[model samples]
Target chain A: MAEVNRQILLVSRPQGAASTDNFKLVETPLAPLADGEVRVRNHYLSLDPYMRGRMNDTKSYAAPQPLNEVMIGGTAGEVVESKNAAFKAGDKVVGMFGWQEFGTSDGKGLQKVDDTHVPLSAYLGPVGMPGATGWYGLNRIIAPKAGETVVVSAASGAVGSVVGQLAKLAGARAVGIAGGAEKCRYVVETLGFDACVDYKAGNLYQDLKAATPTGVDGCFENVGGDGLDATLARMNAFGRIAVCGYIAGYDGVPVPLKHPSLILTQRLLVQGFIITEHLDVWPVALKELGTLVAQKKLHYRESIAHGLENAPEAFLGMLKGRNFGKQLVKLI
Target chain B: MAEVNRQILLVSRPQGAASTDNFKLVETPLAPLADGEVRVRNHYLSLDPYMRGRMNDTKSYAAPQPLNEVMIGGTAGEVVESKNAAFKAGDKVVGMFGWQEFGTSDGKGLQKVDDTHVPLSAYLGPVGMPGATGWYGLNRIIAPKAGETVVVSAASGAVGSVVGQLAKLAGARAVGIAGGAEKCRYVVETLGFDACVDYKAGNLYQDLKAATPTGVDGCFENVGGDGLDATLARMNAFGRIAVCGYIAGYDGVPVPLKHPSLILTQRLLVQGFIITEHLDVWPVALKELGTLVAQKKLHYRESIAHGLENAPEAFLGMLKGRNFGKQLVKLI
Candidate 1:
C-alpha cells in the first residue's frame, strides 16, 4: 500500500496572540522507515498553554520551535509502519511529535497506550501529562494533609480539574476557581470540589473569600494573573503554591502581583514546575493517577477539534478560556 | 536611690515615613515583679526593619502591634533585678523588649548573652537574631551548591550581608544588591561577595545584569520592590528565592510583581520566612553563625544611633535605605 504524509511547519514566531500565519500546512509522501524507527499515523493532538512558550525564540525548559520548524505537541497515534521491534503496526502510543497527520519516531520518549483500558483521548488528558503534573505537584511539593483547604485555579481545565478531584480523594477540602458559573457548577458537582469560585464574576475577591473562609493551605496555580493575586491575599500561613502554569500571562503580557506582601507576610511557598523536567518521577504519579481514573475516583472532559488544520483555532480558543476542558485536536 | 522605669509607646502608625510623632516617650515606675516574671533594665535596643511590619495593623504571619502599645523590639540588656532563678542582677541577657531606656521581662524568650565572649552589640547583629535569620534561610532554604550564583538584596544590611558572607563560605558565587556605591564596595571587599550591584546607581536592571550575568541560582530577598522586579528577571531555571523580609513595602504601600512569568518559566522556588517561627532551628544557626563571626569568616557593620530617642530616626532611615549595615540603638 502507498503511504501518505501530512506536515505542519512553524512559519513565524508569535509576537502576541498566536495566529494561523505562524503555521503552514503541507503534504508530502512518507519516507520509508529506517531501522530502529517507527512510523505513526496521528490520531489525537494535545493543545496546551506550554506550547506558547515554545513558540517564542527565547531559551526555556524546552527548546524553542526554530524558525520554519514543525510546531511541537504531544500526540497519540497508531503505529502504521514499524522498523523498530518495540512497536509493531497497529500499536497505540503517545509521543512528542509536531503538528502532523503522521510522524516517524525512534520509539524514544514514546509510551505504549493500552487502548483496551480507556479511550485514546484519555492518554492526552486525565491519564496523561496534565494529570501527572497535578499528581506530582500535590504529592511531592504540597503534600496536602487531610482536612486542609486546597485551592486550584483553572478548575475546569485538565490539570486543575484533576488536582481538585485528587485533593478531595486525599480528604482535603478542595476549592476550585474557574471562569464561569457553568464551570464552577461542574467543578463542585461533577469533580467533587467542596466549592468553586467564579473568577469571571465581577466579585472575584468576595467570591474567593466566601469559598475559602479559613484560607487555603495549598494552591495549584494554573491561571496566574488577577486570580493569583486574589489567591495570594487569602492564603494561610505556610501555604504551598505549585506554580504549574501562568495561563493568564502566556500571551507575553506582564500581569502585576496584587498584595505582593502576602509572599512575605503570610510566609507562603511558591514553587514552579514543568512535568517533563520531573519525568523521572513519572511512574509513581502515573500509577497513582491511573489507579484513580481506573477506580473512577477521577473524571476528565475534552473539547476536541476535528483535524490538524484546526489546532491553531483550538489553541487560540483555549488561550481565550473558550475551551470547556482539555483541548485536543483529532488528527486522523 | 530611687529606681526609674521608662518606656517607649507607639503613638501613631506612620502613613509613609515614620517620625518622632509615631512614638511616645513615657516614664513609669517599675512594677513590682509578679510571679513568673522578672524585672530587667534595657541596655542596647535592637532596631530592625521587621519592627516596621509589627507597627501596621494588617494581618501577617505574626500578630500586628495594637495601636498605642509599647513599641516592640529586641534588646540586649543587663538584668538589674531578677525574680526568677534563671537570671541574676549583674547577668547580661537578651529579650524581645520594646524600645525603652529601662524595661521588665519574664524569663521566657530571654537568652543569657555572654558579653565577655563577644561584644554586647553582637547580640543584635552577626551573632544574634538577624544573623540567625540569615543563616537558617541561606543554609536551609536556598542551600546553594558550590559555585552556584547566589544573589542577596540589602546586601550590607543585617540579614542579606550575613547571607552573602555565608554563601561565600559555602563556596558559592555570592553577589549582593545594596543602595549605594560604598555599601556595594563593602559587600564585595569586606563581605567577600563575588560582585555587588548598587540599586541606587540609577540603572538597577543594567547593574544587576552586569553583576549576575550567569543569572541568579539563589536569591535572598529582603528589600523587595523594584529590586525584586530586576532580580526576578535574572533568575535561572529552578532558582530558589528566600523571602526574608519585604522592607521596601513594609509600610502600607502596594508593590507589584514585575514579571510573574519568571516564576513559571524558570521554575523558581520562592518561600517566605519568620525567624521566630523556626525557633527550633535557631540554636543550630546561632552556633554556626557565631563561629563565622568569631573566626572572622564573616564581617558585620553597624550604624549605631547614640540614644533611645534616636531609634525612630534610625528606623526611619533604615526603611528609606539611608542607614548603613545593621542599624542599632546604643544606650549607656
Candidate 2:
C-alpha cells in the first residue's frame, strides 16, 4: 500500500478569473482503511469547466467546495485495497474522488467500470458525465428533426463534440463553432460535422450566417458570449436553444444577449439544465454511449497532464481553451 | 345600403414610431356584390399592437401590410346584403375585413357570432384572438402549478388581463406589471390579481421584488423591456417564461436582456410563440373563454373611437400605450 497520499485543496476563492494560486498541494500520510471502506489510487482526475463554479462561494446547482478541503472532481481509478464486499481489489471504478492521488470510500457513490473494450480514463469523459450532458441537451431539449441545421459551440470539446456527432447521426446538418483554425478543422474533418465557424475570425456574425445558410434550427450552447449572440442572430423561427454550460462567463463578467426581443419575433424556445439533477436517464444514456464508443462510432480526444500537483494548471488552461477535448490529470 | 365606403390605406411605413400621417382616409363608391358575396357594415375595428409589425416591410410571423392598400385589421359587423346561402342580412359576424366602414366578402372566412349573451365587441377582445393568446401561453408554455407565482406584463391590456385572471382560476398567485397606477389598481381590484406593480413608478425591480415575496415561478410576457428585465431577475430556479408579445419594442429598438447567464444558473425555460400557429387548441381555448365571459367571471374594458376615420389614431395610440384595455374603432 502507498504510505503517502497527495491532494490539492482550494485554499482561496477567486474574485474574477481563477488562478493556480488559489490551490495548494499537500502530502499526507494514508491511514488504514476502516471496515467496509475501499481505498483507490486515482489514475485520471477530470478537470472540467463546472469545477470553476464549485470554487466560487456563491450558490449554484451544487454546493460550493469548502475552503481548505480537497477540490471536488470526477475520477477513474483502480481499487488498491478494499474492505467492502461490493468492490474487490484490482477492480476499476469511477466516482467523485476529488483532486487526489488516492481516495477512500464506503462504496456508496462509486460504480464499477469495465476497461476491456474501452480505457478506464474514458470513464471520466465520453461515455460518462460529459457524454450524458450532450445526450440530454441534444435529444431531450433541442430534438432537431432530420434536415434541420443544429449548431454547437465549443465544438471540439468533450460535450460539444459528442453533440455534433449525435446531431449528424439523427440526419440533421451539424454546424460547429470553435476557437481557432485547428480546432475548427478537427471538428469538421475528424468529427464529421457539416460545417464549422471559426469564432476567432473577427466576423463571428457573418461567418456563422455564411455557414448556416438555412438558418440554425437548434443550438447546443456550451460557450456563451459573442458566440451565443452570433448564434442567436442566425436562429430560424421556432428554433430551440439548449443552454448546457456558459464556460465563457464562468470566470469573468457575463455576456448579455442583444436583441432578446428576437426570441419573441422568432418564437424560439431556450432551456437551461444541470445533468446531475436528472439521474433517471443515466442508464439509458450510459448504455448508448458505451455501445457507440465500443463500436468505434464515437470518437474523442484527451489533453492529459502528469502528476496530481499539475491538476490546477490543467484546469486553468481548459478555462482559456488551451486544452483540446477533455482535460485530465494522470495521477498514477 | 350606404353609397359611399370610407377606407383607410397604408401610405408609408414608419422609420421608427408609427403615426397617423402614415395612413390616408378615403371615400370610395361601393361596388355591387357579386354572386356568393356578402356586403357587411363594420361595427367595430380592432386596433392592436401587432398592426405595428404588419406595417413594417420586414418579414415577421405574418405577412406585412401591402403598400397603398386598405390597412389589415379584424372587424365585428352585421351583414347588410348577402347573396350567399351561408349568411343572411342582420346576422352578426367577425372576420379580417381590414380598416373600412364596409366590407364585401365571399362569406368564406366569416363566422356568424351570437351577441344575445355576449356583446359583439367582446368577440374582438376577450372571446377572440387576445383571449386565446393568454390561454395558450399560460396553459401550454408556462404551466404553473397551484400556489406558484405567475407574473404578467401589460397587465390591463387585452391579452394580459385574461392571463392574470386565468392564472388566478388555476389557483396560482398572479402578479401584474402595468404602465400606470390606475391600470395597476384595475389589475389588482377589478381583475383580482394578487398584486400589481406599476412599471412607471421608477423603482421597477424593487417593486416587483416586493410584490413577489416568493420568487416568480412562471411569467407570461406581453410588453417586454424593463418590465421583463425585472421579472427575469426575480425568477426562481427552473422558472418558465412564455414570450407572447413585445409591444414595447414594436415601433422602435428592442430591449436587450442583461445577465442572460442567469438562464444557466437558474435553469430557466423561456419560450416564445405566435398564437395563430397553434390553431388546434383554438376550439378548447375559445370554449373556455366564452364560458367564462358569459358567466361574468372574465371582466374586460374597451377604449372605443367613434368613427372609422379615427381608426389610424386609435391604432397609433395603442402602439404608444395611450389607449387603455382593448382599443377599437366603433363605426355605427
Candidate 3:
C-alpha cells in the first residue's frame, strides 16, 4: 500500500473558465481507517461537466465543493482495506470518492460493482451516472413516441451517446449534434444514430433543420447556447426538451435562451434534471445499461489522462470540448 | 335584429407592436342561418394577449387568424336567433364568436352559460379559458406543496389572478408580480396573495428575493422576460414553472431567458402550455372556478371597452399592459 495519498483540491473559484490554476495537487500521509470505514484505491476518477459548477462559490443543486478541499467527483476503485462489514478487500466499488488516489468511506454511499461481463470502466460511463442520466431524461422527460425525431447535443459524450442510442432503440429517429466531423461520424456510424450534425461546420440551424425534416419532437440538451436555440427553432408543437446539462454556460457566464416565447407558442415541456436527485430510476437504468454493455450493444468511448496529477488539465480540456467522450483520470 | 354586423378585421400583420392600424372595422351583411346554425348577438368580446400572436403570419398552438377576416377571439353572448335544439332565444352562451356583434354557429363548440350566481361576463374571465388556464398550470404543472412559496407573474391579469388565488387555496404562500402599485395591491389584498412585487417599481430582483425569503418553489409565469428572470433567481432547487403566457413578448419581439444555467443547476421543470390543448382539465377547472366565482372566493377585475368598434384598441391596450385584469369589449 502507498504510504501517501495524492489529492487534487480546489485552490480558488473560477471567474469564468476554469483552469489548472484553480486546482492544487497535494500528497498527504495516509491515516489508518477508522471503525466502519473502507479505504479504496481509486483506479479511475470520473471528470464530468457538473464538476465545473461545483468549483463556484454559489448555490446549486449540490453544495459548492469547499475551497482548498478535495474536488468532489465520482471514482471507481477496489477496496484495498476495510474495517466495515459491508465491504471486503479486493471488492470493486464506485462512490463519490473524488479526485484522489485513495478514498476512505463509511460504506453508506458506496455500491459494489461486478466487472465480470462489463469492464470496470464501463461502470464510470455506460453503466453508471452518465447512463442513468440519459435514461431518466430520455424516458421520463422527453418520452418521445415511435417515429418521432429526437435531437441530442454533445452526441459523442457519455450522456448524450446513451440518449441517442436509447432513442433509436425506442424506434425514434436520433439526430446528434457533435463538435467535429470525426465525433459526428462515430455518433452516426458507430452509435447507430440516424444523423449527426457537426456543429463546428457552421450553419447549425440549417443543418439541424435539414437533419430533422419532420421537426424535432424531443431534445436531450447537454449543450445549451446556440445548440438549444437551433433545436428550439425546429421543435414541433408539443415538443419536449430534457435539459440534462448546460455545459455551454457552466463557466460563470450566463447563457440566455433565445426566443423563449416559442416555448409558449410551441407548447413545449422543458425540464432540467439532476440524476442524483432521482435514485429511484437508477436501478432500472443501470440494469438496462448493464445488459446493453454485456451484449456489446451499447458503445462508449473514453479519453484517459494518466496519473492523478493530470486530472486538472483533463477536466479543463473536457470543458473546452477537447475530450472525445467521457473524461477520466487513471490514478493507479 | 340588425341587418348589418360590425366586425374588426385584421388588415395587416404588425411588424413589432400591434396597433389600431392593423385592424379595419367592417360592416358585413348577415348571412342567413342554415340547418343547425344559431345566430348569436355577442354581448362581450374577450380581448386577450394571445390574440396578438394570432395576428402574426406564423405557426403557433392554433392556426393563424386568416387575413381580412373577423379577428379571432372568445365571446360571451345571448342566442337571440337559434336554429338549433341546443339553444333558445335569450339563452346566454359562450364560444369563439370572434370580434363581431353577431355570430352564426352550428351550436357546435358553443356552451350555454348560467348567470344565476355568476355573471355572464364572468364566463369570459373567472369561469372561462383564462380561469381554466390558471387552474391547469397551478394544479398540474407547479403543484406547489403546503408551506412552499409559489410566485405568479402578471398577477392581476386574467390567468395570473386565478393562479395566485388557487395557490393560496392549496395552502402555498403566493407571491405575485404585477405592472403597477395598484395592480400589485389588488393581487395581494384583493386576490389574497401573500405578497405582491410591482415589476414597474424597478426593483424586481431585490423585491422578489425579499418577498420570497424561503425561495420560490413554484412559478406560474404569465409575463416572461425580466419577470421570469427575477423569479428564477429566487427559485429553490427542484422548482417548477408553469409558463401559461409570455405577454411581455406578445408584440412580436423575442423574449430571451437570462441565466438559463439556473434551470440546470436548480433542476427546474419549466413547461409551456396553451390552455386549449389541455381541454381535458377544463371541465374540472371550470367546475372549481365556477364554484369559487359563485361563492366570491375567487375575485376578478375586468377592463371593458364599450363597443365592438373599439375591440382593436382594447386588444392593443391589453398587449401594452395598459388595461388591468381581463380585457373585454362590451359589444351589446
Candidate 4:
C-alpha cells in the first residue's frame, strides 16, 4: 500500500453547471489510524446526484463538504490495514470513503462486503447505497399496491433502475421516464417496465398521458422540471410521490413549475428523502437487493470511467445525461 | 316561507382564473324533503380557496363542480324543520349546503350545533371546517415541535389564522405571511403568531429573513406562488410543509415557481392534504379546537356579508384580498 494517497477536492463552487474547474486533484501522505480505526484502499467510487448538493456549502440534512476538502462520496474497497476488531486486512468493505484512492476510518459506519459471491464493484452499484435507497424509499414511501401504476424518472440510472424492478417485484405496473430512446428501450425491455416515456421527446405531455392512461398511483421522482409537472398532471387521486432526487434542476438554473396546482388538486404526497436518513433499513435492503441481483430478477448497467484522473470528466458527463446508467470511477 | 329557492350554479368551467360570468344565480322551486330529509336555512355560507379547484373540470381529489350545477360550498345554518331522528327544529348545524339560501339534507353529514357559548359565526370560522383543517394539518402533518419556527401563508384568513395559533399553542414560534399590514397585525397580535410578514410590503425576502432568523421548520401553506417559493428558500433541513391551499394560483393564471431546487436540497416535505380525507379525526379535532377557543386560547375574525345576493361579491372580495378574515354570507 502506498504511503501517499491522491484525493479529489472542490476547487470552487459552480455557479450554474459544475465543470472540471470546480475540482482539483491533490496528494497527501496517509496518517496512521488511531484505536478502532481501519484504512481502506478504494477500488470503485460511486458518482450520484446527491453529490451535487454537497458541492455547495449551504445547510442541508447532511453537512456540506467544506471547500478544499476531499469531496465526500461513496466507495467500495478492500481493507489494507486495521486497528478495529470488526474488520480484517484484505476484507472488502463499503463506506463513505470520499473521492480518494485511500480512506482512513474509525470503523464507525464501515460495512463488510462479501466479494466472493459478487464483484467488489457491485457494492458501489447494485447492492450498495444507490440500490438500497431505491428499495427502502419505494417500499416504504410510495408503497405501490398491486394493479397500481408506479412511475419512475431516470429509469435507467442506478437508483431508478432498481426502483422500476422493485415496483414490478411488488406487483405494480412500472412505467419509466428516460431521456433517450436507447435508455427508454433498456428500461422497458431489460428492466421489464410496463412502459417507458422518452422525456427528451418534445411531446412529453402527450407521451406521459399515453403511458399512464390509468393515471399514476406512485411516482419515484428523480428528475423534476416540465416533466415533473406533466407527470403530476397525470397522477391519480391520493397519489404518492417519492422525491428521491431533482436531477432536472441540478443545473442551478431555476425551472418554473408549470403545474403547481397539481399538488392540491390531486392530494399528492411529495416528500424529499435521503437514503442515509433510513440507515437502519440498510442491512435488510442490501440483502434483498443483493438476492434479487444474484437471482437475475434485477439487472443494472454501468458506465465505468477508468482511473481517478477521469472522475471529474465522468461526473460532468453524467450530469449532462451522456452516461447510460450508473456512472462509476474504477481505481486499481 | 318562499316556495321557490334562489341558487348559484357553475355556468361554465374556468379555463384559468374564475370570473363572475362563470357563476349563474338562478331561482328554482324548492322540493320537499322525504321522511329522512331535513330542511336547513342557510345562516352563514363559507367561501374558501378549495372552491377554486372545484371550478376546474380536471380530475382531482374533490370532484369538480359540474357546469350548470349548484356551486359546492360549506355552510352553517339552522335546522328549521327536520323529519330525521338525528336532528330537530331550530337546531344550528353545519353541512355541505352548497351556494343557496336553503337546502335539504338527509342528515348523513349534518352535525347539530349549540351556539349558546361561541357565536354562530364561529362555526363557519375557527370552530368549523376551516379551523379543523388548519389544526389537523398543522398538528398531524407539519407537527412542529417546541422551539421550531412555523410559518403560514394567508395568515389572516380562516385556515392560516388557525394554523398559526395552533403552532403557537404547541410552543413553536409562528410567523405569518399575509397581503397587507392590517392582516399582518391581526395574524401577529390577534392570532398570537410571533411575527407576520406582509407580502405586499415590497420587501418580502428581507422581511421573511428578519422574521425567521433561525429558519422555518414547518410551513402551513395556503398560498402557492412567489410566496411559496420564498418560503421554500427559508426552510430549514427536513422542514414539513402542509399544503392547505393554492389561493395564489387558483385564477388559471400561473405564477411560475422560480425555485424548485430548494425542495431537493433542503429535504422539505410538501404534502397537499384535504381535511375531509380524514373525517374520523374531526370530532377529536373539534373538541380540542373548541376548548382552545372557549378558554380564550384561540381567536377568530369573521367578514360577514349580509344576504345571499351578496355572496358573489363577498367571494370576489376575498379572492382580491379585501376580506378581513373568514368571508361569510348571512342568509338570515
Candidate 1, A1-332: lDDT as tens digits: 34766778888988887888888888878788889999888899999989888888775677888877678889999998899999999999999886888888899988898877677888889889998999888887788999999889999999999898889888899999998999999998989899999988888888898989898899899888878888888899999999898877766777878677788888889999999889887888877777777777788889989978888888888988899999999976
For every model in order, the fraction of real contacts preserved is 0.88, 0.84, 0.87, 0.73
DockQ of each: 0.85, 0.75, 0.84, 0.66
Separately for all candidates shown, the number of backbone clashes (residues 3 or more apart, or on different chains) is 0, 0, 0, 3
Alpha carbon lDDT at B287, candidate 1: 80
TM-score of each: 0.97, 0.98, 0.98, 0.94
Q: Write the per-residue lDDT of candidate 3 for residues A1-332, one digit (tens) a residue.
A: 88899999999998888889999999999999999999999999999999988888888888899998999999999999999999999999999989999999899899999999998988999999999999999999999899999999999999999999999999999999999999999999999999999999998999999999999999999989999999999999899999888988887778899888888889888888999889999999999999999998999999999999999999999998999989899887
Q: Give candidate 3's iRMS in Å, 1 decimal.
A: 0.9
| TM-score comparison, 1 vs 2, better candidate | 2
Per-residue lDDT of A45 in model 3: 95
Task: Please report, as a residue range, the 10-residue window in candidate 4 chain B with the lowest summed lDDT.
Answer: B252-261
Residue B320 of model 4, lDDT score: 82
lDDT of 1 by residue, B135-185 (tens): 988988999999899999999998888999889888899999998899998
True-structure RMSD, every candidate: 1.5, 1.4, 1.4, 2.2
Positional deviation of residue B194's Cα in model 2 after best superposition, in angstroms = 0.6
- CA-based DockQ, model 4: 0.66
| Interface RMSD over true interface Cα atoms for each candidate | 0.9, 1.3, 0.9, 1.6
Q: Lowest summed-lDDT stretch of 10 residues in model 4 chain A? A: A53-62
For model 2, residues B1-332, the per-residue Cα lDDT tens digits are: 68999999999999989888999999999999999999999999998878888898875778899988999989999999999999999999999998999999998879899998889999999899899999999999999899999999988999999999999999999999988989999999999999999988899999999999998999999888888888988989999999988876777676778778778888999999988899999889988999999999999999999998888888877877787899999999
lDDT of 4 by residue, A29-104 (tens): 9887888999999999999888887776665667777889888889999999999999999999998888899989
Interface RMSD of 2: 1.3
